[model samples]
Target: MHAWAMGAAVLSVIASGAKAEEVVLSPSSAWVLDYGDHRCRMTRAFGEGPTRTAFMLEQTQPSDTFSWTVAGPLVDRFGKGKVQVQFAPAFDGFEIDHDASLRVAEFGTAVASVTHEAPPPTLISRTAKPRLRSEPDALSDGTARAARLRLLNPEHGRSIARLTLTKGGESVSLSFGSLEAPFKAMNACMDDLLVSWGMDPAELREATTAARWINSVPLVGKIQEFYPAKALEEGAEADYRLRVVVGANGRVSRCHMILLSRGSDFAQRVCDIMRREARFEPGRNAAGEPKPAFFSTKISYRVY
Candidate 1:
């Protein structure tokens, strides 16, 4: 959900430093629901390499509204300045006079928060005497303010297809999936959050008779090395999610793509790899009998 997690996955692959005869680019379109620390969020990420980015829509209990975050290298390019946001269908743009600061240490991400109406004075006085100004401006240096923007804005309407961010002569555009699925996931997460809050013991127990992994393989290196050359030439990066079913024999019974970044040979190649190369230990029941189990994971490929 967070850029840090995605970056860590990429870094792990890079650290392995493996080489393959061919490269494979993974597909994108995976949704993950996360709940923790009195919060719930529905998230999805896209792109690879420097373009890696993630969108997270979150809500806290007792609050009917939602807050969203767009993090990754794409947002960092805007720097700290005023940018214009244009939504499709109407193409109407809104001027956002906000601060954009980069967090290089935390996955090279940035936050864009709208400036507040009344900002507090700086901790330290610049001059020998405290100079008072006629009008005080909003502080636009932190993420505190930007976190207030509603994810579902009335003006923007539903079914937003694309978003364009422009700062002076530089601009970038991003495509979004249909809003229906994400909103549905968000509502489900909200329900879970409320249930957790009202639990009698205040501690939820884990589901019983769950599947456990005995032997797992790391596929990041193999994926990176096998990235598709056509995708590399086109500078395309994709995020893919696959549902893998393992039978009692400790072999992948079937693998299917739940999400595809874009229809291409690359996606087909990755799916083939998962079906042929992926292996997993069988899951066991409470009686210790081997049973079939299903597992899901997201894979991403980027060319630098």
Candidate 2:
């Protein structure tokens, strides 16, 4: 696809939302993650208390050099967490293991750590499943052309290539195939290598489906019950995440807390109320059908 088309695809993935309870407020700043930068928002809720927090970083290089920025409520200790990051050059995934060091300064004390594990390996074959049909890598004139580059790892049984899909003006990249075939065996394999990089169609579908449910489901109107808590008070807030079921009838069928911030009373209270009151618009399938889907939400307690 053209550069604009690719930018649009990336933009679509960034715009996602989950309903927030009375105690939780959405971030005014857009959560932007570039190839090098990363951010995470965590929340916690208990009884009638709720709190939300955010962690931010701007990475200069995938291998090294990054600036860390943290905001939201203060906490006593950090907890277990996992993070995934995408690498560039449009390869299937990142080649080097990314180890992160977190430094926290609180209450006149500074604490840093490199205990978290490195970013996981992104094996291309792990995502390949049912492959797509291949035809001549043609341009608008409908002529076959030579392939420029190919990604092949016989050891892992995965390969893809870049071919001139269209003529010079409208050329695009397409990704296909999981198993390793002679690069020449596939007519447009070279073209695939040139344009499109390694991608996991199945993983893309699964992640997108789950993300759609979270974004489309409406959790604003059904708030059956609600109350405010002090855990969200400037210096005393927290962050948290929750897994919820958006029923076909546009209501939250069930919800469970996923992550909780230490001493975050505000997060807990907001979560309880959300579980009781959140509503969904329900989701439709390709046939214009409505179906129950899984969704998730994150909340943070921040000072005004």
Candidate 3:
């Protein structure tokens, strides 16, 4: 098999929803990882020159999710409606909401962040709580990719390299070679992020029974009223993430805005609402005693 076909992993999502013209963007740069105070991001460029289209994956704390976004000039041209992002050699594909994000349809470097039910957990979405879903409803893109990357050892050249993007019938594939080091760095950075959040990396996996969002419907309704006016005017959307710290009493202590998809501000309003109205069944330690714990969730908001 050719190098391109070797272990080709295609990390694809519709950044914008306006049907793309005849354009195929390929890999231009190596994957770069950034360890920020609140998040871990891994980015790569597609399209041979000027970094026209770039793919970004960011995770704040250790979770099966990413603020997966694709940016560049051509993004605004993508068509609206349903689009699919595929993780090959394993499954066919899944859908992403393209009605917003890059749909701004303006010229010059448009940024589109899609609201997927799962992003990484497929490259972005309204982050869902980490829970057990019966059967396949539980298997997510982020979860699958993380699992695959972790097992990238012993089977070295079996995971990363040359991810392809197939959108609107135009084919854009990457030429990545060995994700060993990049993935290693990304994972290490995530561990550090967890620690920064006052969370122990080793204990979080199963340390406490995962936090639960028990009463949140009213909060979501209130959030719809706080849509940023700037974002509304530009037709921009969001898949905002929140890090909620639940006390042992099954109450929210505080909240943090970890990721914002749009270029405007609505996170404050949403986080404020969450802190006041959102209630959860606090997580408990292995001893079945109430213990403080935090969880990150993706909240897709709108003005309706």
Candidate 4:
């Protein structure tokens, strides 16, 4: 799990520019994941004339985990953009769901956006292995690092990530170790970085935002199916989302839903399954404070 490979794996996904409308201006993409946790956030945006278009995904919460991808044409694609997304709970982990999309048309100063959608099933892992590729560049005034990380379907070996890192005039070709175990690759990179700074992973895990992962099994499953533009009506199967917090005791302490299907029973079922199977390891904050952090996930219902 070298830094070069890891960074490549994680960045590949972002580099795979989804087919955005031509009207898009200064379009950008972002991916964020919680280490060892099943939650991830992805956002994309572009500008039109007076409006903009945006797509956001937030997977994993205290109660469940799910994912959705959507796009739309908007009036302007600039300034601040807002997006809404949806998915299913971890219990309802087997189903197709519908998500939302937003668009805008302007170029402002904001650089990032928050989104909610279920993450890819393969990305959900207890450890991450991110590989980064770094190259040196020379400019008239100084030198810099250029990098890219591959982000993609780990099981299928598809390149889904491409990350770029630049210092001064040179960019670091940062990437994940491989297209496989994106989560693990990231973990390895983070660990290496901490160690390089003469710090321990445990020390950082303890003080910063932390989560006590119980069970700690690698849920290496593939996405069996994907439903596009399908909506749940009444008992006709529902859509839900959940976020879980594994405490130091190795058990689920909190389960929250960012979205739910048509029934309360759906939400309850999601919580029940997670509580029965989740695990954890005691965590610490940046200041070496022992506490339980949060890991969010999403789930959807399917005929499975």
- Give the winner by TM-score: 3
lDDT per residue as tens, model 1, 1-304: 2221211122101111133221111214365777654456666555567656665666543222454566766576677768776555444676776466434343456453321222221111111222111111111121222112123333333455655566655555445524455555555554454454332111112112323333232443344446566766776655444445556675666665533234335556656765667665445444555555444444445454
Highest lDDT scorer: 3
What C-alpha lDDT do the candidate models reach, one value each? 0.45, 0.28, 0.52, 0.34
Which residue ranges in model 4 land beyond 4 Å of their true spot? 1-21, 24-52, 55-70, 74-235, 238-241, 260-265, 272-281, 284-290
lDDT of 2 by residue, 137-246 (tens): 20112111111111233433343231111211221121222223321222122223212223222222222112132222233211212224343333454444444555
Which runs in model 2 stand beyond 4 Å of their true positions? Answer: 1-234, 260-263
Query: Cα lDDT for residue 247, model 4?
Result: 59
Q: How close is every model to the real structure, measured as TM-score?
A: 0.40, 0.30, 0.61, 0.32
How does candidate 2 fare on TM-score? 0.30
Q: What's the lDDT of the predicted structure labeled candidate 1?
A: 0.45
Quick one: RMSD of model 2? 22.6
Query: Worst 10-residue stretch by lDDT in candidate 2?
Result: 4-13
Best-first order by TM-score: 3, 1, 4, 2
Candidate rank order under lDDT: 3, 1, 4, 2
Report how far residue 8 has shifted in candidate 3, in Å: 18
